[model samples]
Target chain A: MKQAKYGLLLYIFLALPPVASLMESVMIVHMHMQLTLLVLSGFLMGTFFKQRFASFFNNWNQSGVPGVILAVVIWAYWMIPRIMDETLTMHSIEIFKYISLPFLVGVPLRDSWKKVSYTVKHILYIFMTINFIVMGWIYVAINQQICNNYLLVEQRTLGFGSFAFAACMIIYGFIWIFSERKEHQQSS
Target chain B: MEQTIKETIRYPKKLLGVNPNDAKVSLAYLSVAFISLLIGGLLGLVQGLERAGLIELPSWLNYYQVLTAHGLLLLVVFTATFTVGYQFANLSHSFGGLLPKVRTLAWVGFYLMIIGVGMVVTMIVLNEASVLYTFYPPLAAHPIFYVGLVFVVLGIWACCLGVFINYRHWRKNHPGQVTPLLAFFAMGVFVLWFFASIGVTIEVLTLIPWSMGLVETTNVMVARTLFWWFGHTLVNIWYLVATSAWYVIVPKIIGGRHFSDKLIRLVVILLVILNIPGGFHHQIIDPAISQSIKFLHVFMSLSIAVPSLMTAFAMFAVFERTGRKLGGKGWLGWLKKLPWGDVRFLAPMMAMLAFIPGGAGGIVNTSNQLNQVIHNTMWVVGHFHITVGISVVLTFFGICYWLVPYLSKRKLTPKMNKLGVIQTIIWTVGMMLMSTSMHIVGLMGDPRRTSDTTYGGHEVAASWIPYEMVFAIAATLLLIGVIIQVYAVFHMMFLSPKGQTEFPVAEPEEHAPVAPLWTERWGLWTVLLLAVIAMAYVVPIVDMIMNAPPGSPPIRTW
Candidate 1:
């Protein structure tokens, strides 16, 4: 409940015109910081939905595979350069970005994260790291601007940001397997 | 209500007592630290006198040369050696003893650092490296000077490895147990040390090539950015070292229980994560970095204050709680119950007091508009003089009164304790006079880092002369203070009566909850630390590289 309340506050703050404009002004900030934070906000708000509609999640996400797939698919769709441009040009598409990133992608992630098994979680980590690296390589290597809204330099910045994200995922995954899970094994 | 030290400490006897081999390691480092303090203090006095127009230097001994030596010796050698010495001592005491390999590594580090310092000092003496401690680019030093710095960083890396190994070994051996507070601090200190040096090491390695003419030119903005990443975090490293004393040692000296263990660990974790991004605050007045980025950085810079504020609150709470326990009454009456007469308590107490002004000045320096007024001015010098000179150095001084005696298996005599109290007062007064004058003159538009204060008879520069004189006089007094402190350390080490001196680590109150196991998650913290560093740095760094100005060739302004 507390998390849900804070997440609502975060959602409102991110939706504020000043914040949205400021974050969107920078290409990497829009893709990396703002979009990631929106997902985070939804993940927090998922606590409320989980409690309020427990039976639906239990029925639909018992093994967590369906929810994980839905979240990854939605996230992958948004990562396409064309869709990112569409959000800027069309008001309806922009609204859909704000709605679907949280409800469609983030909410599913929150629900599936704990329900998934160890092997499934490990595979997810590998996929995300590889995905980010491949995206980063594309963004950096391309001489032309990939997006209608952003400059070539901004595109390169975004590319570096993706590599950073990839590196972080790799480190976290290694640590998770090596050390973090030991606590779980012992405590459980 | 008097509690015995033995009754308070629940650790095994072997762990509580000083191990002789470990004592040798700590003592060797401390000796080097004090020797650097003496040399650095003298250089500071000479620089002060030169700045005051009292003495013209002989041709070979330039003010900038002395200034370079002074800054490196004290800021780098003195602070670093003292921290390693003290932390290794803490690790030894808390862990029962250092691993044999770790001890060997400490010796290896010592020799490497001495060699580095030797090369650096020789360069300064030859007037080949008049570059100030920051070593800003375009001002090239001798190739050997940068090589010397490389050796120093490698030395530090060796010590960092030693700590990591010891800590890992401890964790493996003592499964499911919380690491002792002091050992935890050692881990945090070295973790920051190792990561912080990465940026500087990169800077120095590239600099070697540039200085050697192998590279045609180097990015000035990129170089400065890299330097500050290490530089700003180094400031926090000293602060963290002082906190180890304030949190663990001060409580026992004042006869009180330590603060909540969880909170202490949280503060450590926060400082480590939030610190590297704070390099931007140092570059606020520099060009090429956009205002929007600077605006974003304000949040990162000030986030460190959260842990700082937490520390202030925690220290006060510990004092008030202890003072009350000692039967003091009313709100502020608890203050009098503190051990004001004890040098171990008195020196650090004054150090903590100085931080009120020091921390406030730091805030001013962090703000964009405020920094524009005082950037590269004498106020920046004053700000650090108060923060590092008093807040950090005084605490280190406080640690010495007991730590030296403890290492030597000697007791601190009542007379020597009085001398320490006197030394603390002299230092406090000297720094207060110097820093206050520096701040006032800085606000009057006096620039720093130059010997020629009168500025060819300009009116504003003439007005600063009186302050400069005051600064010189204060420096002289500080020299006297330094001599007394050095004498005291030696006396405690050798001349004092041979007796056991206990290492004072405060126990937590019995009723306090067991600190959570989550606090031991260093891997998670390390990952987050990298992620945060990447988040803050990657964008601007990329921007700098892609849109860099024509890189500057090595220039010798001298």
Candidate 2:
């Protein structure tokens, strides 16, 4: 119940003008914050949704595959260079971007992730890691303006941010694996 | 006598434990790639000769037409087809066997690609589409050319889908198991290809209608932007697959253990993510976009080098490890201890050596200030030749030397094997001469893509003559090398004596029963990927749409 309140607050914060503007102005922040942060909020929202509507989600996403796949697809759609552009220029897209990310992708991802098999969860994680690396590459490598509104330095900053994030994720994975192995050895 | 003949002719049920059907499918893909290689090689010779001013291209066959065919055949058709074939083999062998349905779908993709290549090649020959391989319009090709490219992309997508399905099925069946490294690499290649091709797909959809006069004009910058998006990723697609062979196959061939599995996975993951947006680096000189964006891309371009750098380090580590195990003592003794006589090792090893300079040259090309000095010059041409030409093409040649024998259930003849080593050496020497001269003359201000450099005997043209002569010599050596390679591959495929074939699988230094679970989580990684892409591209693409200049009608300069 406490988590649900925090989720609502986070959602409200993301919707605020100052935060939204900052995200839109800087390419890296938009990617690292507006986009990634929204998903994180949705994950929080999923915890709330699970607590409040346990039976509803369980019945709807028994295997969690559909919900997870939906999250992935929605996330992929936003990644398109064109869609990124639209979020700034078109009002409808901007609203949809905020709502869909938290409610649609974030909410569903959290709900499905619990129900998802160990194997499926691992696959999803790997896929996300690769996606981050690719996005960083695009941000840094492209010479032309990918986003008309943002400056070039912002794009490069975002590119570096992407690499840093990816590195952190990999390090986390390595530590996780090391710990898991050590536990297994001890148990055996 | 009848029994002996029957035994000799009978197809093996399993090649490298892969079903005969799967083997046949892989072989079919390779055969098409090889055929394209032959055609592309001949065209390259013609291009070199014509560029050197030694031979006149017939009036009917324009220089640009040949250049278009050469680039398309070698870079697009040959590299893609071979990578697909090689990946299929790797996946099947690694995973035990692919589903029959997956194999069938792959065949469908194979035929579609062939048909597409056939259509495009025919149009080029007929002089209906002389637009260079870049096909950046305002210079429009025939509608058929665009349609043909669409088919090729669709075919590749179809193949990717099959691989995806097979991978999913494997995951379902083997719960809690990590995917094999080679299979993981194949999946990465297709996924990257699928994403990278989206830019080209948009270009084709827009351009096809315009070429057919369904649209009266097309936005040139928009089209060029889309093409570059696809173009840069396309090169990485080639490099990634060859890198896979280097990581998985090369170490084993030299009797070295695999590099750290975690590190390799990290490298591949980095490559797939970083490879795409770097395409904008190619368009730095264009006035349609702002300099800030170009500057951003320059930074992104440098990041793409990370994977290749990782690869270089890992490759040397593997070699050093192997060399020391074989009793080499000094710092450079391992290099001498390597199997220099074996074409399988030598070709790719030499190719790796060439990439150091080639990759460095690429960094220079991407630099905003420096690019002005070399953009659209023969220097750019020389850079790619060392990369795609020597690094990628030579690596593929090495793969073929072993792959053909494995598929055919035959032994490469001793004489032909020796000749294969000779062939690689010839290629190395030829590329050095040609690329060196090309690089030197480019700094002297010779433009690329022009048929004639004379320009009514300008003073600069007189200075270029010596380099051109050297290029002619290099081209001749390269041609001889191509002939020898083709002969060796064909002879191995058909006439080599029947023998048992070996598939090299590296034994890891420290074997773990199962890979870390997080390495397999493709779903999460994919979501993150999209977000990053959105961050990189959304603003610029929207800006293009909102501020687009009026479309330009087609013009045929040729």
Candidate 3:
């Protein structure tokens, strides 16, 4: 319980202009720290709510499919270079980034991940993998600046990151399918 | 039917037989690796201090010479020897024992590697090979250096061949059973190493003759291209060996069951296929390669990160399952329940954590456009320090804690155990300081591989001095950690009280009788691996050869 409270306080503290400004000044930290840490803070807060909202979560995400989908959508939104740029330029978007990541994405992911079937989880992974590949292709292929604030080079670097992420997903899918098939063959 | 099931479940004691000769060989390899690590680490500190302008080099030891020694000893000697020794232990324990012939060959390989390392070191110390570890020619080394490196590669190949023979014998006896996970991982690493070495082998064989003045000139671009081909794959081999520890060894110490054996095998197979060809990412900025080939290489490099990502997910899942079983509740609760105090578990876990940023930096590195900004900068130095330095080296240290004791039949003293923990903490803190500063300074346009950052007191270079100062301090911390670790390892091997300890093996969550047959198809996988390599290299190599320039004769810059 204390951990949850501390997490919330930490989230609020990080949201302060001084801290946020310092973090967002650096390109790598903006992505790795400000954004990623925001999600982690949300995750920590979600643990306290798990018991309290058990019935509500179970009713909405019994199979965990909806929650997983929502979380993925939220995550995919943030991966966009344009969205990242908006956080720097627009104040409202920055606030949204702070609030939505934890409550909407991180919280729901925690609730739904356990409820989802292994098959469904893998299917979700495939979708995420494709998402990364497409994002990477867009980032690398486009010569024009995707983000108003970041340099063209920074945008392209983000593209490579997307490619790496997608690659990992595809590899995971390959391994998952192979392993499952082997199990089915032997069991039958 | 019941008896067959019982036999399957029974522990295979025959496979765990202890051989004094094998132990001696393993110890010898480890000793060399440690010695290399200590020397390499000191050289790194010297380089860091030089970069900061805090120290003057004695006339005998130039900056480039120290750089070459640092890169060669740590990246090649320490990593290669430790991996071979660690894998030998794994194979011997899992297979019961290596055949006497195989054991004899392994010793021969060990001696050959030692001889090779000695020659390379001698040349570097004599200022005969200041070309840096890349040995990117036109800046040539003494012929002995190239020959010595070739000897090292051949020695590793011989050791790998022994592992393959042992696996074949095991398969012949077990019939339908899947290769045990550790053995499977060991085989995958060796196979990958074998194929990857082909490019370097060609490069070295050609370079040796050229360096000896047997040939008038050498193709500089072609040599570099081939070196990158061997280079990236070599890093992956190091990564795979560390991953093997994460998969097979870490789980046991933490009381976690193995993730599905099939999944683990699949990851290994995927690595075997994707680990090569990605080397083009290193050459993306080079002039000779076409844009299309470079782009394709970027994709391939991106793809290789997949297996590593899979490892992260699978490892986390294993931890979650174990923690839940031990009464951990909530989303992040499992993290706390882990045996954080145990150096064996803590060190590797921390290494995995470091890989998140390290791996992310790798993506930035592979970006063709982005490479123009950060390439050959301190950022790259920071990137690899996290990836290969902290992640790979620290994990190997964790393995040694238990492995040394297991092989030596000696127990780690409480004092040494305390020091081991301190070593890991200090290493983590030191790397954080050094790499963070390096990354930031790199973005400020600080060049790497240069002895001095202050280019005639230019404003830009002057601004980087503070970061360089931070790096020097970090190096000091790292040196202290290295000393403690070396002392601990030495004491555990020689002075610690003797006791028997079992090689830890985690049971799978669920038992499956028949192993997956497709995973065992090594010949097919090898063919696939070669085909991918061809797709990546054949066009580029052909292009370079067709439009050949007059090769350059050796230049001795120092």
Can you write out model 2's per-residue Cα lDDT over B1-558, one digit (the tens) per residue?
988654432322233433467778878888888888788888988988898899999899989999999999988999888998889988888767666678888998998898889889998998888888898799888989888998899899989999988787776555566788999899889888988888899998999889988899998888888898889989998898888888888898898888888888888888887777788888889876766667667867789888889899999999998999998888889887888888888899988999999999999998998899999888988888889878998999988888888877788666867998999999999998989888999999888998899878899888988888887888888888877877777777788888866777676786534457567666545545554565456556655655778888977888
For candidate 1 chain B, the 10 contiguous residues with the lowest summed lDDT are B7-16
Q: What is the lDDT of residue A50 in candidate 1?
A: 91
Candidate with maximal DockQ: 1
lDDT of 1 at B237: 96
**DockQ numbers for every candidate?**
0.71, 0.06, 0.02
- Write the residue-wise lDDT of candidate 3 on A1-188 in tens digits: 77678769878888888888866764434664477678777777887878799888878888888888888889888877778788888889988998888888878877777788878777777787787678778867999987777665545555555565565556545644644344435545
lDDT of 1: 0.90
Pairs that collide in candidate 1 are none
Give me candidate 2's TM-score against the actual structure: 0.77
| Kept native contacts, fraction for each prediction | 0.65, 0.00, 0.00
**Tens digit of lDDT per residue, candidate 3, span B1-558?**
988654533423453325576777788899999999899999999999988989999999999999999999999999999999899888877877666667887998998998899999999999999999888788889999998998899899899899988887777666557778889998999999998888889998998888888899988888888898889999999999999989988899889888878888889999999888888888877888867668667878999788888899999999998988878899989888898888888889889999999999999999988899999899999999888878898899999888898788888666766788889999999998999999999999999989877888999888999999999999999999888888888887888889876577888876644447779877657766865674566556756765678998988999
Q: Which stretches of candidate 2 lie over 4 Å from their true place?
A: A1-188, B1-18, B511-514
